[model samples]
Target chain A: MSTDPTANFSGDIAGDILTTALDWKNAGKGVALATVVTTWGSAPRPVGSQLAVDDEGKFIGSVSGGCIEGAVVTEALDAIADGKPRLLDFGVSDAQAWEVGLACGGKIQVYVERLDS
Target chain B: MKREILEQLQADRADKRPVVLATFLKTGEQRLLYLVGKKGLKDLDPRIGEAARAALIEDKPRTLDTEQGPLFLNVFNPPLRLILVGAVHIAQALVPMAQLAGYEVIVIDPRSAFGSVERFPGITLSNDWPDEAMAQLRPDLRTALVTLTHDPKIDDPALIAGLKSDVFYIGALGSKKTHASRLERLTAEGFGPDDFARIHGPVGLSIGAKSPAEISISILAQMTAALRQPAATPASSSAAA
Candidate 1:
């Protein structure tokens, strides 16, 4: 297997994430895609930002400024296992946000869905 | 998202097509909307189509409340483009600045001496005539055109092309008198007041700029304004340095 993160993908950042998800899925690895669908108050990442995760917990791209990727990755793994879509809300007010270190005081809603045929 | 839908979206993006993916947050259902060419929506909600078009024009992703549920309209607009009709000194300054602002800059000048590679190192240089180059480029909504060459032979064709196309910004560098005469000539060619109104003669903001670099800064600022705030009235064209 190629060690390059973008070995089979070539495009912009968003395109790369989608391409990676598809590539991982075709390779028989469970894949889930997480996208930042909405944001409020100084969110580091803009809406439509994406992250692609594999069942192995390997990931590419980001939905936050490295503040909530771990939690998102955990959700992505569960999504891949259950083949169920999930909407994750992370904000400064949420207790889960403190655990996930979303210390930027901004809020983001991420949509995580397993890539299905 | 389904594998086929993802593939189609990737294919559209690869082809530089402006597409919007509207996804229902509750059901994870997705529908692709194309800004140009064939209509992709059939038996779908018209409100979704309207919102998709609005999102495309705004060049931003947005969430819309719908009868079904909240829909996320993810806009995938092609990268912004800046086409310079003249590879003049101002263009030499503007090209790098526009590139830094995330515009894919293309310098078009038929004159081999003026549009040489040494003058615009690591830039896309086109020696085709302004009219020919504009036709080939087919400036779209995400593109901006500027005519920097004072010569009517070069700038006029470019200005005409810019007026005919969907380019968001059309700027020409000249004095007020020159602009008047240029407008007169264009008017003689059957262009109306609305077409002339679209051209930003004496291009650039009313910054007291005399040097080529400063003038480039002003022009880029005007382009940024035209892009980000499309609804706002453009700055008056009288204050050209």
Candidate 2:
């Protein structure tokens, strides 16, 4: 918790993520944004969390606490290339969850969609 | 998909309208619903629009499993607002404090000198009369109304307007005797005790605050408590001198 009154964290990142996706698309770089649409149990992030990824694998924001960001980024890359959306689900059942120490446990569904200007 | 919706969403957000952008998971089709007021950009399925409106009212963002398929209803709310009915010394201290607490502060005072920018740097100033300005602002559930002038003419009308609205918090600054007299005047105008009870007279918590800045802190603390803990009982009023 920052004591600086000027430090504001109440802002939601959806608008910023969307604006970045649009700008990337307009700049001739394919872009896709992954949004956490659903969460069950102790999900690290809430629903509506977003991560924007360009064709070059550049990304901003996060849908999870590094537990599933890698997979989301890969899916976002595929979404940008195919111009189709992918709903990717990650949870404790997967071996990767244990590898990332996310077994504290929860399920998160990220909807990765391409952004075309 | 047209980028026009993105532009419109930006515009709606800039306008501080409560809006929800619902997107179909399968097709990536999106619809913008202005859920705060009845007005909308497009006429959507009544079920979805109503659900979106309910979500906006609850201030929640969620993915709803609808008959049309899974749709993510992303809720966007305007910044919380604090409308100060009087640009008194306390308001000068309160404005920046409220702004720091993530509230978009608006100060309303008919007296130009009192409401001048020099006294209240970087805050929205409304010089209109309290009743007129309150009507125009139309404080919603996300807004907090506070009157610090201690003048019945200025503070009473503003309190009436606030009482009529759905603003989550209402506080009036005055002494205990002044509050009783003020209550009498409002009662003479047909307002009952129940209506007056909604007000936190001798405004702010019973924190034994003396300085203007200290009082502002107490008021902001009370406002935050009212907003975050709606179920909690109101704090007891301290004797005002």
Candidate 3:
């Protein structure tokens, strides 16, 4: 629900997120894009926040303010490998949230999909 | 997303066109919605079109639960623009501040002496008269205009153009008596009180700002308020006399 459309993600603008994904894809690397589709409570990153990942597990941008990016990157790597899209839901109540450290009492659903070659 | 769509989206943004990417969650299919002259996309579901219009207006992305399943509307709006009608000292201070706040700053002043590149480096400068410049700029919903020149020969025409456009904010720098005289002049030009109300006369919030830089801050703060809180009563109207 952030009003600012140009909100910074890891000091990168929204355009840069997609541009990076395009660049990685153009470089012949497997690429996946994760977007926060919905959120509840105090989600650090608002819905539409995006994170781009490559097959090497390198990531740009953020989905949860460094709280659950690691988990998202892992999911993105899987999506890239399988060329399959998946929706992931993370909440404070889930033990997986504790493992990935999304302990901010917020819930977010992230959609991870690979960039079609 | 397909590479062609990604490339198209990047080019649309580069051209400052407002667009929405409607992603169907179940199939990963996306429909790129380009707004056609303030109208909803043709042949689109009225419900989804209405939601996209709302998302563009609010400049926020959203998820809509439609009968077709969940769809995510990712809004891509052009960057905000700030057009300063005078390359005064305050304009010098305001340019960097506005850019930092995510606005593309442009200074318009026919006086080359004041609008010189040396005075405002790396900033867009226009030597054309205010009216002509505003005509070319076509101030829109995302544009904010400030008249810093104390000369009616310059500020007046700009104010007239700004009042006619849908610019989010219009601020003029002057005193109460000066603004009163300005209103009289504009009134003679067929502008009504409703139009006058749009101009933040005696510009900026009542911060008692003395320095040029402080005044710039007050003006930017007022612009931010007008942009972020359109429903709130303007604080400068009481001092607009």
Best by TM-score: 1
Ranked candidates, highest DockQ first:
3, 1, 2
Mind giving the per-residue lDDT tens digits that candidate 1 earns over A33-57?
9988888898888888889999999
Off by over 4 Å in 2: A1-15, A40-42, A65-67, A97-106, B36-51, B110-119, B125-139, B160-166, B180-198, B205-214, B229-241
TM-score of each: 0.91, 0.76, 0.84
lDDT of each: 0.85, 0.78, 0.84
State the displacement of the C-alpha of residue B172, model 3, in Å, after optimal TM-score superposition. 2.1
Can you give the DockQ of every candidate in the order shown? 0.42, 0.34, 0.44
Candidate 3 — which pairs collide? none
Ranking by TM-score: 1, 3, 2
Question: What TM value does the first chain of each candidate achieve?
Answer: 0.86, 0.79, 0.89
Kindly report the docking quality category of candidate 2.
acceptable
* Candidate 3, A1-117: lDDT as tens digits: 354447422222344888889989999999999998889998888888889999999988889999999999999999998888888999988889878888788999999999986
**Interface RMSD to the true structure, each candidate:** 4.4, 4.0, 3.4
Candidate 3 lDDT, B1-241, residue by residue in tens: 7777878887777666778888888888877786566343566578888788778766778888877788899887777899999999999889999998888899999999999999999988999999999999877777899999989999999999999988889999888888989999999999998898888988988777888898889888888888778778464443332
